[model samples]
Target: MASAKPKFPAIKPGGSLILAWQVKGKHVVVVGGGEVAAGRIVHCLNADAVVTVVCPTSGLNPEVAFRVSEGQVKHTDRNFEQSDLDDADMVLVAIDDPAASTAIWKLCKERRIPANIADVPPECDFYFGSVHRDGPLQIMVSTNGKGPRLAASIRKFIAKQLPSNAGNAINSIGNLRVKLRSIAPDPAESRKRMAWMTKVSDTFSWEEMCKLTDEDMDFLLRYYPENKAPSFSELRIAQGAPDPQGVDPFDGSFGFSVGA
Candidate 1:
């Protein structure tokens, strides 16, 4: 009898994993000098990687070439060789020639070096994602290297929905998290406190949250003994009203009515 194929949940390529690679302070090698390469280089730089670009034509991009010339990056004016992969933490191939990029891709795979070949999925270990930065927070969107343009469009849409004060709000929440972690006695209690904190942060106004003083934080902690208190501040405004004085409604001074 034919058995039904075993069903397994399919995980997309860009979905979060139990373990993720850390590229901070690593060496990233780029094999191109065009605009695409420039974009990849920017991403690597943001990740704090020491970036190196290998290309033959200095005329491809003046800004990038100048940066390389100024020692901001390591540059080699030639095609890629196996030796280029030496000491490289990761490789990004964005050259105009697919054959050359593919060759490098194969070598990187063989040597177990993570590689991303621009516009080539089968040859890539990972792909660049569209990113939006709000102060220290970064939001990333990716279509698993399937549709970069679509990812970029989605990013723009999301950027509009984000609040103007989202960065400040995030900073406030982070500060709150540190305080909660320090006071919570057990790990389980800490997780519960963090959940309450997140709920409070999400519900409050940015202005009220930002204006919260030490006294307000104390009040919250005292009031909510079981849960971490979300910080808030009082809002005050002046209401327009006339003073208690005899004055004409239309004129500035007291006066008899015209009919009387």
Candidate 2:
């Protein structure tokens, strides 16, 4: 039989493709210790990257200096050297010296390593979008280096519209999924679990999902194979929650959904 033909049109090439890069345990060399560099270092550290900051002691900002003093980041008390990029998985240049920054960008190009030269969109291989983080959930808004302020405003708006317990809901669901996997380890059980989880998701509101406890997860594990998993509302009622009243906070009618 012939394979299915493509249904969608080819994408036009204008916007940048957003991605969640995994940099955990990777080495990120940041050249400069100014405020911008300090912010960049924090972002890298948040992702569990090994970070090195290179700059003269005089150039160190208070934020960077504090981290360096506590030995959170390795600091080279001098200008950037070519050897700084030796084991670097990525580089971020935040110095005011145009010549030095450009030279580093060129070296990164030669080594085919991704680099971001602060405030220089053309010299950067990646752009840092305004990020809104909630536990394991992250929403990033980017304008492809055009308008950072606008991107930040948009991210703020997006964040404001989400339910406060959104992250908790995600965490509970994730744990439930882990329990489901353990209960149904067979590969053939994949579809069955997926359908059950989807049903549970569609049936429960985010607030209801967030209230799920280990007992709820245990109940799911026991009944998932039997295709009789209980709705989260039932579990909540059993736990003395008043009968659910009013509209769900996440019913896609709270001015949050596209074209709502």
Candidate 3:
């Protein structure tokens, strides 16, 4: 008999890989001191990158000037030079001089270093997405350099639907998970813990989970050995928590079409 067609479709190419790059302790070179460059530097600093700005001091905007004055980033008070790319793990070009920017981009290409030349998508090795941050939680929206304003709007819409305390809930859950692991170290109990945690997660709302206490956790652990999670009603009663206020679900469609 002929082979039946596969149920799933083949992977589609041509899309950027959405990733959270770990840049901590790595060197990032920013070759401008304009407003866009200031924003790029801030993002790099947030990721704990060792940032250095190479621009004439006269070119620096107020924000970039303040960052330099505070000693947050090392500053080279001149235009970019070939030696600037020597220790750079990543490069960001935000200068208005297209010829200079293109020249630097070509150098980065020869050195095989990833670079993003602002306002020139063709020259960029990567694109930045509009990001929403809440503690350890981050939501990013990308339109592949086609519609950045729309991406920002989409990010704002998503942020409104999430509970304000969602990050706190994640932190609380992490701590509880660590405590649970310390209490149940037996290898054979792994599956039970896994199942119990899964059900518990499915049953609790972000707000309810954030309110979990030590006594509540102790009571919950009693059911772990049985490979069971407490029911939503049971947990609510134990913790005196209220039902979650639901956000209207997004229909997974955009109201308006977006294009470059």
Best by TM-score: 2
lDDT of 3 by residue, 5-87 (tens): 98898898878999898999999999999999999998999899999999999999999999999999999999999999999
What TM-score would you give candidate 2 relative to the actual structure? 0.84
Candidate 3, position 227, lDDT:
59
Better of 1 and 3 by lDDT: 3
Go through the candidates in order and give each one's C-alpha lDDT.
0.70, 0.83, 0.83
Worst 10-residue lDDT window for candidate 3 reads 251-260
Please count the clashing residue pairs in each candidate, in the order shown.
Answer: 0, 0, 0
**Per-residue lDDT value at 47 in model 2:** 89
lDDT value for model 1: 0.70
Q: Write the per-residue lDDT of candidate 2 for residues 1-260, one digit (tens) a residue.
A: 99998999988888988888899999999999998999899889988899999999999999999999999899999999899989999999999999989999999999999999999889999899999888888898988878999999999999999888678889989998888888678999799989988877877777788777777767545546556545665544433456566544345333322111
TM-scores of all candidate predictions against the true structure: 0.69, 0.84, 0.82
Ranking by TM-score: 2, 3, 1
Off by over 4 Å in 1: 1-21, 57-60, 144-146, 181-260
Tens digits of per-residue lDDT for model 1 on 84-173? 999899999888898888899988989899998998878878767889878766888877667879999999998898776667666766
RMSD of each: 12.0, 7.6, 10.3
Model 2: CA > 4 A from native: 1-13, 228-230, 238-260
